[model samples]
Target chain A: MSAAKKTALCAMLCAVSAVLSTLESALPLPVFFVPGCRLGLSNLAVITAIPLVGAAGSLSVVAVKSLLILVTRGVTAGIMSISGGLLSLAVMLLLFRLARFGFVGVSVASAAAHNTAQLAAAGLLMGDVRVFSFWWLYLLLSIAAGALTGVAAGVIIPPLGRALGAR
Target chain B: MKKLSKTPLFAAADIFIIALVLALAAVPFFISVKGAGAPLSASVKINGRDAGSYPLDNAGEFKLVGENGIEMTLVVDGDGVFVKDSSCRDKICERTGKITREGQSVICMPGRISIALEGETGGADAVVG
Candidate 1:
């Protein structure tokens, strides 16, 4: 793909991710196990960006989404969201390099990392280790939802990749 | 020369790291297994008007008025807090479960209603800020 086209695609993905995150935040899932966790649909954009734009591009998308949410919301929520996004991007990039487990594995791994990162961030900010007590249930939910989203991305990315001729 | 094609040690390190995270995630279920009796009781007010005080005994049922002139029943158990019933088309708040412990919250975006377990900032335990 041409440089201009690649930039546009990346921007579009970032926008979609931001909107998804905002909407998901508004609609909090009533999980039976983990109380405060959500599906974090924006992560789909982050994971897909890994294979397309590489680490820098994926990180850029996360940064953009985090900043947008931070600017719109206050610092408390922004800090937790940004921490999760950065951590998810880091794990996804690493896993993408190591194994060809396809998009499904990447999504699941990123989602797990996202929850872990958020809980860790909360513990750190609150100065209490008990904040991490919700990790198990949230991680399971993250993995399950991440796999679902990753499968959807896997199915969608190929055609888009071929049409855009993304290498 | 064929013996030099060993996989990088970093790959093994990655597997180890992932395993460690999964294990850490499971620790919560074991540690938080102790059922914490109702740790909080407070009055919920909207726009300076008395909605109601959440009863500590049950800790599973409460009421609040929404912006649309409708009432919402909230429930909290050991797991979390949630809206048992609401008049909104979107049952988003109902999906967010009941939060009993400190630092957990359930919000009704459309109704502009929020029920939160106040952090250790102040209560009967300490002076309110």
Candidate 2:
């Protein structure tokens, strides 16, 4: 694909991810294990962008998504979102390099890494390690959240790639 | 490039990751439960410094000032402690709900404050002699 086409596709992916992120926060999920934990539905677009737009494109999607959260949530939340979103995209790229793992594996691991990174960021910002120990349940919830996003990505990515004429 | 496959929602690598995460997730629960007893108090920390600790039965609501001049209202009751109000936008601390178990806590990341339930430190392995 041409550079312009890739840019357009990345922009579109970013828009979709931003919408997903907004939608997720608006939905009241049946979660009690941890505070502020969501199903990471926004990550579905990033996962789909992995094969269609590769690392750079996916990174933009994550960046835009975080930026949106920062504007909507607050400064601290924005920082956490960027840290978590970047780490998540990095993990997804690394998993894609394996070339054999499915979307579920990558999305699941990415979701877990995102939550871990955010908690770690919160701990560092607060200058405390206790946050990790206190919020261990967040990691446990990542599995189901990751699978949900992965399933959505799995259904959308193939068709999206074919339509976009991507590699 | 090979596209992400859908037939197998979970592959060998996914299973391995799930196992690893599950084991990691269980570690904290084990540590928290190992030395716990009936919680008797709640301790509040702001910006990594201990602000104060009160009896679990303190049964009153009080405000705390944390880093960045963040204000949080914490409620301490007979059964548990929780954030009644917070200045942070997300209100995650407020949503953490009441924590009753020893070693459990409610934290406000934006406010840089944490409220943890504290209990007596004793175990069956302790020897009277």
Point to the candidate with the largest lDDT.
2
Across residues A1-167, which tens digit of lDDT does each residue of candidate 1 receive?
67787788889889989888889878766553345567768887887677676677778899999898778865656787899998888877776666645566667778888887876776565444444545666776776687678778777766666667765
Report lDDT (CA) for all predictions: 0.64, 0.80
Q: In model 1 chain A, where is the ten-residue run with the lowest total lDDT? A: A125-134
Top candidate by DockQ: 2
Chain B TM-score per candidate, please.
Answer: 0.51, 0.81
DockQ of each: 0.10, 0.54
Once model 1 is optimally superposed onto the true structure by TM-score, how far is the C-alpha of residue A79 displaced, in angstroms?
0.7
Per residue, candidate 2 scores C-alpha lDDT tens digits across B1-129 of 455444245577788877777888888766766545454687788888889987876699888998777898888888888887688776888788888877777888877898877764433344343
Question: Which tens-of-lDDT digit does each residue in B8-124 have in candidate 1?
Answer: 213334444446556866775554433234355434545334455464445567677766565788775544456778886555456655556654445543455656554322344
Candidate 2: regions farther than 4 A off? A31-33, B1-8, B120-129
RMSD, every candidate, angstroms: 8.4, 2.5
Which regions of candidate 1 fall more than 4 Å away from where they truly are? A30-34, B1-23, B29-129
Give the alpha carbon lDDT tens digit for every residue of A1-167 in model 2. 78899888889989999988889888868764468889988888888787778788888898899889888887888999999999998888887887656777888889889999998998888877767765557777888888778888777777776677764
